[model samples]
Target: MDQFTINLLFVGASFAIYIGIAIWARAGSTSEFYAAGRGVHPVTNGMATAADWMSAASFLSMAGLIAFVGYDNSAYLMGWTGGYVLLALLLAPYLRKFGKFTVSEFIGDRFYSPTARLVAVICLIICSVTYVIGQMTGVGVAFGRFLEVDNTTGLLIGAVIVFAYAVFGGMKGVTYTQVAQYIVLILAYTIPAIFISLQLTGNPIPGLGLFGTDLASGEPLLQKLDQIVTELGFNQYTAHDGDTLNLVLFTLSLMIGTAGLPHVIMRFFTVPRVADARWSAGWALVFIALLYLTAPAVGAMARLNITQQFWPNGTDAQAVSLEQIETDPAYDWMATWQQTGMLGWEDLNGDGLIQYYNDASPDMQERAAAEGWEGNELNNFNRDILVLANPEIANLPSWVIGLIAAGGLAAALSTAAGLLLAISSAVSHDLMKGQLTPNISEKGELLSARIAMAVAIAVATWLGLNPPGFAAQTVALAFGLAASSIFPVLMMGIFTKVNNKGAVAGMLAGLLLTLLYIFLHKGWFFIPGTNSFTDAEPLLFGIKSTSFGAVGALVNFAVAFAVSKTTTPIPARIEDLVESVRIPRGAGAAAADH
Candidate 1:
C-alpha cells in the first residue's frame, strides 16, 4: 500500500480502538466522569498514567532536543523521571487517601476555605490550559504529517477526536483509551529504535547500543558520535555546554512541575486504594523508564545517522550536493519533510553543495571561508521533527513509518484528553459545584464538564496555531507555572498544618510572580511580539524564565511559613483531616464514596 494509505489505516485503527474503549467504558455519573468510579486497577491506572504523562513533549520532542543539545538536555530526562519519585513518595498515597476527585478539591477541602479552593482552581486552569496548547500543537504536527493536511486542519480534527472521547466517556473512557494508547505508542517507539540500533551497532537494544560499539568504526557509539559531530563543527555530543546553575534550576523546575501538574496528580485519584496509588506510581515509572532509557539512544543514533547521510563520504569529504538531494531516492525524506516547512535547505553562496555544519563554530568559519561557503545550508530543521522522521532517515519499512504516525497521534491525543479532563473537572467540580453553584445537579455538572472540555479544546487549538516554541519547550512553560503555583501549596497542605490564609497568600504570590517573570521573557500573555526581554538574557539572576519555577516554588514555601506563623493556626477539625490523610488504612472505605 501507499504511505498515505498505510498511515491512514494504522492511525484509523488506533482511533477506532480508543473510540471502542470509550464506548464500552462510558461514564454514567459524576463520580465516574471525574474519577473513573474509583475502580481502576493499579496496573491499568499505571498504564493510563504513563500514556497521559508521556505527552508529545516526551514522545515527539524530547529525543530531538537531546539530539541537538546532547548532555545539556539531559535535564529533561532527569527532571521528568525524578519527579515521579516525589509523586510516589510524597504525594500520591496521601492524596489518594484524602478521597477527593480532583487536586483542587483536595486543596480546597484541606485548607477549609472557599477562597483557597478558588485560588487552586485558577492555578489549575492556568497550568492545564498552558499544557493543552502543547498537546494541541503536537496533534497538529502529527496529523499534518500523516494525513497530508495543514496544521490548522489537523489540529481541528484532533480536537474533535479528543472531544468525542473525553466529553462522552470522561475519566472512565479516558482511562481505558489511555491504556490502549500506551500500548500502541510503546510498540511504535521501540520498533524503530530496535531496527536502527541493529543497523548502527549490531545491537538489538537501543539503550545498550547507545553505549555499545559502532560496527562501522569499531568504537563506542557515543565516542563515534562525539567525533562525527565535532568534525562537522558542532560541539562534542557528551559535553555539558549550558550554564550550570540554569541547568540545575531547570531540572528542578521540571521535577517540581511534574509532581504538581493537576492532570498527572488526578491519575492517582482513579485507583481503588492508597496502596494501589503507590504501586500505580511505581508501575507508571517502570513504563515511563522504558521510553526514557531508550530516548538518549534514539537521539544519539539519529544524530549520527543524519550526519552520515549528509556526508556519506566523511565529514572531511565534500558535503551532499543539491543535485543529489533533489534526485537521490535516499534523500527523498528531505523533500517530503520540506513540504511541511519544518525542514529546509538552501545553496548559500550559490555553491550548490549542502554544507550542513554549524556556522557558529570558529573552525567551521575558517573552513567555510576556504570553501567559499556563506553559511549553514540546513537552516530550518525543526527539532520537533526528529523522532517522526527517524524511521524514514534509517530507511525502515513502510509499516513501521505508519506505526510511528499512529504513535505520535496517540501520544498527543492521550495527553490532550487528560489535560482537557483536568480543566473540565476543575471548572465543573471544583469551581461550579464546590463554590459557584453548590446546588448544581450531577446531570448538570456532567453537562458542564462536557461544555468546559469543548471550550478548553477550542482555546488550545487557537493558541497552538501560534505556539511560542517547540512542543516540549511550550510544555515546559506549563510545568513552570504548576511548579510555582500548585506544587508548593499541595505539598504544604499535606505535610503541614498551614492555615487557609497562608495557603491563599502563597499560591497567589507564586502564581503572580511566575507569570510575571515568564511574561517579561516569553511575551505579555504569551502574545508573540509583546515581550520586553528574551530568555537568552533573563532579568532575574541570569536564570531563564523557563527555569524560574524552582525559585518561585521556594518563594511560595517561605511566604506560606511566614504568613502562617503570624496568623491563626490550623483549626482542630482541619488538623484532624491532615492527620487522617497521612495514613492509608481507611483507603478502602474512602473508595466507597463513589
Candidate 2:
C-alpha cells in the first residue's frame, strides 16, 4: 500500500480501538467517572498513568529538544523523570489515603474551608488548561503531517477525536484506553530507535548503541556527532554551555510541576488502596523509564543522520545541490514536512546548493563571504518535528512510519483526555457539585462533567493553533505554573498546620508572581516577538521563564508559613485530621472515618 494509505489504516485502527474501549467502559456514576470505582489494579493503573504522564511533550518533543541543543537540554529528561519520583514518593499515597475525588477537594477539607477548595479548583483548571494546550500542539503537528492537513485543521480533527472518547469515558474510559495507547506508543517509539541503532551503530538496543562506536566512522557515536556538528558551525553534541544555576532551576521546576499535575494524581485515586497507589506509582516509573532511557540515543542518532544528509561527503565537501533535494527519494521527508510549514529551506542567494551551516556563527562568517553565500538556507526547522519525522529521516518502512502516526496521536490524546477529565472534574465535581449545587444528583454531575470536557476540548483546540512555544516548552510553562501555584499548596496542606487563609494566600501569591515573570519573557504567549529574550541569551541573565517555578515554590512556602503563624491556628479537629493522614497505621481506615 502507499504510505498515506498505510498511515490512514494504522491511525484508523488505533482510533477504533480507543473509541471501542471508551464505549465498553463508559462511566455510569460519579465514582466510576472520577475514579473508575476505585477498583483498578496497581499494575493496570500504573500503565495507564504512564500513558497519561507521557504526553506529546514526552513522546514527540523531548528528544527533539535534546537533539538540537545537545547536553544542555538534559534538564528536561532529569527534571520530568525526577518529578515523577517526587510525586510517587512524596504525594500519591497520601492523596489516595485522603480519599478525595480531586486535589481541590483534598485542599478544601484539609484546610477546613470551602474557599480553599474554590482556590484549589482555580489552580487545577489553569494548570490543566495550560497543559492541554501543549498536548493539542503536539496533536496538531502529528495530525498535520500524518493526515496531510494544515495544523489548524489537524487540531480541530484531534479535538473531535478527544471529545468523542474523553467526554464519554471520563476517567474510567480514559484509563483503559490509555493502557492500549501505552503499548502502541512504546512500540512506536522504540522500534524506530532500534532500527536506526542497528543501521548506524551495529547495535539493536538504541541506548547501548549511543555509546558504541559508529559503524560508518569507527568513532564513538557521540564523539563523531560532536565533531561533525562543530565542523558545521554548531556546538558539540555532548557539550553543556548553558547557565548551571538556571538548568538546575529549570529541572527543579519540572520536578515540582510533576508533583502537582492533577491528571496524574487522579490516576492514583483509581486504585483501591494507598498501598496500591504506591505500587502503581512504582509501575508507572518503570514504564516511564523505557522512554526516558531511549530518548538520548534517539536524539543523538537522528541529529547525526540529518547532519550527514546535509553534508553527504563531509562538512569539508560541497553542500548537497538543490537539484538532488528535488529528485532524490531520500529527501522525500523534507518535502512532506515542508507541507506542514515546519521544515523548509529557501535559496536566499540563488545558489543551486543549500548550505545549512550556522551563518551567524563568527567562524562561519568568513566562509560565507568566501563562498558568496547570503546566509543559512535551511532556516525553518522546528525542533518539535524531529521525532515524528525520525522514521522518514532514516528512510524506514512505511509501516514503521504508520505506527508512528498512530503512536504520536496516542501520546497526545491520552494525556489530553486525562487533562480534560481533570479540568471537567474540577468544574463539575468541585465547583458545581461540591460548592454551588451540593444537592445535585450523580446523573446530573456526570452530564455536567461531559459538557465541561467538551468545552475544554474546544478551548484547547483553538489555543493549539498559536501555541506559546514548542510542545515540550509549552508543557514546561504549564509545569512552572503548576509548580508555583499547586505543588507548594498541596505539600503544606498535607504536611503542615497551614490555615485556610495561608493556603489561599500562598496560591494567589505564587501564581501571580510566576505568571508575571513568564509574561515578561514569553511576551504573554500569543504575541511571540514582544519578549526580550533572544537565541544568544535564551534566559534573562541566566534564568529562563520556565526556571522561575522553583523560586515561586519558595515564595509560596514562605508566604503560607508567615500568614499561618499570624492568623488563627488550625482547630483541634483539623489538627487531628492532619495527624491521621500522616500516620501510616490504619491510614485507610482514617480515610473512611473522614
Candidate 3:
C-alpha cells in the first residue's frame, strides 16, 4: 500500500480501538464519570495518567524543539519527567487520600470555603483550556498530514471524535482508551527511532546507539554529531551552554506545574487507595521514561542526519545540487514534506544547490560570498515537523510511517480528551452541582457534563483552527497559569494553615498577575496584533515568557504567605485535615465517608 493508505489504516485502527473501549466502558454515575468508581488498578491508572499527561507537546514537539535548538533544550526533558517525582512525593498520595473527585473539591473542602474552590475551578479551566488548544493544533496538524485534509477540517473531525468518546466514557471511558493510546503512541515513537539509530550507529537499541560508535566514521555517534554541527556554527550536541539559573528555574517550574495540573491530579482519584496512588505515579513515570529516555537519542540522531544530508562530502565541499535532489529517491522526503506546506526551498542565486546554513554566522557569510551564494533560500522549515519528517527521511517502511502518523494523532487526541474531561467536570460537578444547584439530580448533572464537554470541544476546535503561536509557547502559558495559581494554593492547603481569605487572595493574585504577564508578552488572548515585548525580550529581568512560570509561582507563594500573616489562621479542624492527609493509615475509611 501507499504511505497515505498505510497511515490511514493505522490511525483508523487505533481510533476504532479507543471508540470500542469507550462503548464497552460507558460511565453511568458521578463516581464512574469522575473517578472511574475508584476501582482502577494502580498500574492501569498509571498508564492512563501517562497518556493524559504526555499530551501533544511531549510526543510531537519536544524532540523537534531539542533537535533544532541543541542541548539548551534539555530543560524540557528534565523538567517534564522530573516533575512526576514531585507529584509522587509531594501531591499524588495525599490528594488521593483526600478522596475527592476533582482538585477543586479538595481545595474547597480543605480550606472550608467555596470561594477557594471556585478560584481553583477557574484556574483549572484556564490552564486546561489553553493547554487543550495546543493539543487541538497538534491533532489538526496530524490529521492534515496523514489524511490529506486542511487544518480546519481536520480539527473539526478530531473534535467530534473526542466529544463522542469523552462524553460517553467520562473518566472511566477515557482511562481505558488512554491505556490503549499509550501503547499506540509508544510503539509508533520507538520503532522508527530504532530503525534510524541502527542505520547510523550499527547498534540495535536507539537509546544505547546514541552513544555508540558511528558505523560509517567509527567515532562515537554523539561526538561526531557535536563536531559536525559546531563546524557549521551550531552548538555541540552534548554540550550545555544556556543560563544555568534560568535552566534550573524552568525545570523547577515545569515540575511544580506538572504536580499541580488538575487533569493529571484527577487521575489519582480513579485508583482505589492511597497506596495505589503512590504506585500509580511510579508506574506513570516508568511509562513516561520509556519515551523520555528515547527522546535525546532521537533528537541527536535527527540533527546528525539532517546536517549530514546538507554537508554530504564535508562543510568545505559544494552543497548538494538540485539535479541530485530531484533525481535521488532519498531527497523525495523533501518533496513529500513540501506537499504538506511545512517544508519549502528556493534557489535565490539561481544556483541548483540548496544551502541549509545559519545566514547570521560570520564565517558562513564570508564563505557564502566567496561561493557566490545569495540570501538563504530554504525560506521556512518549522522545527515542529522534524520528528514527523524523520521516518520519511530514513525511507522506513510505509507501515512504519503509518504507525507514526497514528501515534502522533493518538497522543494529541488522548490528551485533548483528558483536558476536555477536566473542563467539563469542573463546570458541571464543581460549578453547577456543587455551587449553582446543590440539589441537582445525578442525571441532570451528567447531562450538564456532556453539554459542557461539547461546548468546550467547539471552543477548542475554533482556537485550534487559528493557533495563536508556537506549540511550546502556548503550552508554557498554560503551565504558567497552573504553576502560579493552582500549585501554591494546593501546597498551602496540604502543608500550611493558611486561612480561607489567604488562600483565596493568593489564588486571585497568582491568576491575574500571571495572565497579565503572559498577555503582555503573548498578546491579550494571544491575538497577533497586541504585544509589548517579543518572548525573547519579556519584561522583568529579561526572563522569556517560557521561563516566567517559575517567577509567577514564587509570586503566588509570597502573596499567600503575606496574606496569611494578616488573617485569622485556618481552623483547628483544617490543621487536622493536613495531618490526616500526611499519613497512609485510615485513608480508605476517610475516603469512604465522603
Q: Choose the strongest candidate by lDDT.
A: 1
Q: Which stretches of candidate 1 lie over 4 Å from their true place?
A: none
Candidate 3: worst-modelled 10 consecutive residues by lDDT: 229-238
lDDT score of residue 138 within candidate 2: 91
TM-score of 1: 0.99
**Candidate 3 lDDT tens digits, 85-204:** 878888888998888789999889888999999999999999999999899989888888889898778888899899889999999999999999999999989999999988998777
Say what the RMSD of model 2 is: 1.7
Clashes of each: 0, 0, 0
Worst 10 residues of 1 by lDDT: 585-594
TM-score of each model, paired residue for residue: 0.99, 0.97, 0.98
Q: Please write out the lDDT profile of model 2 over residues 177-243, one tens digit for every residue.
A: 9999999999999999999999999999998999999999999999999999998789887887877
lDDT by residue (tens digit), candidate 1, 1-594: 899999999999999999999999998998999999899999999999999999999999999999999999999999999999999999999999999889988888899898899999999999998998899999999999989999999999998999899999999999999999999999999999999999999999999999999999999999999999999789999998889999999999999999999999999999988989999999999999999999999999999999998998999998899999899888889999999999999887887798899999999999999989899999999999999999999999899999999999999999999999999999999888988899999999999999999898889889888888889989999999999999999999989888999999999999899999999998998888899889888897899999999999998999989999999998899988999899888887866754
What stretches of model 3 exceed 4 Å from their correct place? none
For candidate 1, the lDDT comes to 0.93
**Candidate ranking (lDDT, best to worst):** 1, 2, 3
